[model samples]
Target: MDLVKFFHMNGGVGDASYLNNSGLQRMGIMKTRRIIEEAISNLCKSNIIKYPKTLVMADLGCSLGPNTLLVGSMVIDEVAKTSQEMGLNPPEVQINLNDLPTNDFNTIFCALHEREKKLNTEKITDVHYSPPSCYFTGVPGSYFGRLFPAESLNFVHSSYSLHWLSQLPKLREINKGNVYLASTTPESVSKAYYEQFQADFLQFLRCRSEEMMVGGRMVLTFAGRTTEDPRGEESYYYLWRPLAMALQEMVSEGLVDEVKLDSFNLPWFTASPTEIMKLVEIEGSFTIDHIEIFDVNWEAWKTKKYDNDNDNDASTDDNGVGHAVAKSVRAGIETLVANHLVKQ
Candidate 1:
């Protein structure tokens, strides 16, 4: 599908939706946030780093709205609670919410504004509240370069985002027969996925190592798979392939030209726990504070519960599925496929 059309069909559904309460509940974002907060609290208790005032945080791939605010609030609340328990003053905090330039900045800005208004009206004077700032940038490209200065950040957190690389792999490098717009074979695609992830992830860690202060903590949560299928029949792929095939069928019916479908590839990848652990080992700077797999309660479209819903209701559920699929698809597209699947 033409990039623009594909985006029009699927836009505002990926990371953007994940930043909202509905999508967060479906993807266990609140649970992940709690885990991250606890980790930050533990780090504070150990005195591995100073409390409150010195803490600076960044949320990589923070989409557009409420989740960004929630992340900022969670960090601040955790720091304040920890500081009070320790009889120390709460820290000065700066949260940088980062994402691709194409993300909904207006929504993020609005969310931040709302958060600030709430804090001001409540006269929340306990901790110094700094407005969350946002940066339009992608993880693989400019994240380490201009977004943050050297040795400035105290904590780094990314949820359902890091699996994507800055870009896709090179077409010339892959085997001939194994290549397809969407490869279903595990071996053919897994090697490419692993290679790109290993490289981009190592770069991510190295960049963070430079950006973070000594003893800083980093927490990342992402979608993972039990199987090694490059194009396996998982719920994620099931959600997207229909859309992709729909677009392709549109091409066949002459609703759109072949060029349109040719330009698009499904974006998604899933990493096993072992694969992630190996990548961490190669990256070296980050210590694995905790790794927990939580269930993502996806309400599939073809399920009986969805059959009776109206288009609006179906679309809402579709948007949730879209969010989950985007994370997985973006990972595969960016990390494994040679073709540029994700628009940006």
Candidate 2:
């Protein structure tokens, strides 16, 4: 399937929409907020441009949601706060919220004006309000390639986005009977995934390197494993394993074709920090200023009980896992499923 045509967060404010089921992604943004703040502060303090009159920043893969603006607000707030502390004037913040062309950018634009008003009131002071301001724009494209002009960006951020490959690697014959990496997945399949990640990530860094000014900072936090192996326990088992099982059950019940399941593979890959560092070395564009890891439970966003609360709770199963996982995954990839697997 062509991900560019179909890979989008379930659009609108419907029940299955990304805005409704994106609590896990929101948690990830919150976890990495401090790092983003520190990066912005570093940009402000760095001698590269000495805090230029206009500050340019981009949030890559900023899909439509309330959390989409959360970090944008933080970046603006940090710039204001850091400038005040340093006794320097705040620069006009030009923020570009980027995602795939298929993303729900209209929803984000609709909510943006009100969000700007609220953030300005809360984060900025009246002295520089008339001149030094914050502007928000949407840039729609894949981050795996160049998306901005050369030397235009001062900071870049991407959270929970890099794991998605530009497209599934061309190894369908080797990775059979699974939509993602499984414990039984062949070594050839794993190698294909790793090679794709290396290529994608290297391209990502090269593009950012061209776009960002010297001494610029990019704070990225994505789904990655600590181990060298891509199929390690923390990487896939926590989520995709059970999701694949659910699909397998559907196949057994005759709702889905077994052959289709055998042919379909998700365009997602988790890389180790070592792998990422090696690629950064090869690309040699951005230096690794700092790195950290944090874990969120699979069921971190699930409510204890649903309103129905009957024998079968769609919020959670007997083991208290799949319901939330299913909703979250569906929010992200349901479009692909509808376009390719199901007969629409």
Per-model C-alpha lDDT, please? 0.56, 0.79
Q: What is the TM-score of each candidate against the true structure?
A: 0.72, 0.89
In model 2, where is the ten-residue run with the lowest total lDDT?
Answer: 304-313
Residue 183 local lDDT, model 2: 71
The alpha-carbon lDDT assigned to residue 137 of candidate 2 equals: 90
Report each candidate's C-alpha RMSD, comma-separated, in the order given: 6.8, 4.8
Question: What digit string (tens of lDDT, one per residue) describes model 2 on residues 1-344?
Answer: 67876689987887678877677777677778778999888888884355588889999999987778878888888888888877788899999999999999999998897775775688534665333487889998999889999999988988889999998887845566567887778888888888888899999998999999987889898788888767666677767777677888988898888877787788888887888888899998778988887776555556533222122223243444666677778888888666656744
TM-score of 2: 0.89
lDDT of 2 at 164: 93
Which candidate comes out best when scored by TM-score? Answer: 2
Off by over 4 Å in 2: 117-132, 303-321
Cα lDDT tens digits, model 1, 89-143, are: 6666667777665555666677566766776688556455433333222332234
Give the lowest summed-lDDT range of ten residues in model 1.
1-10
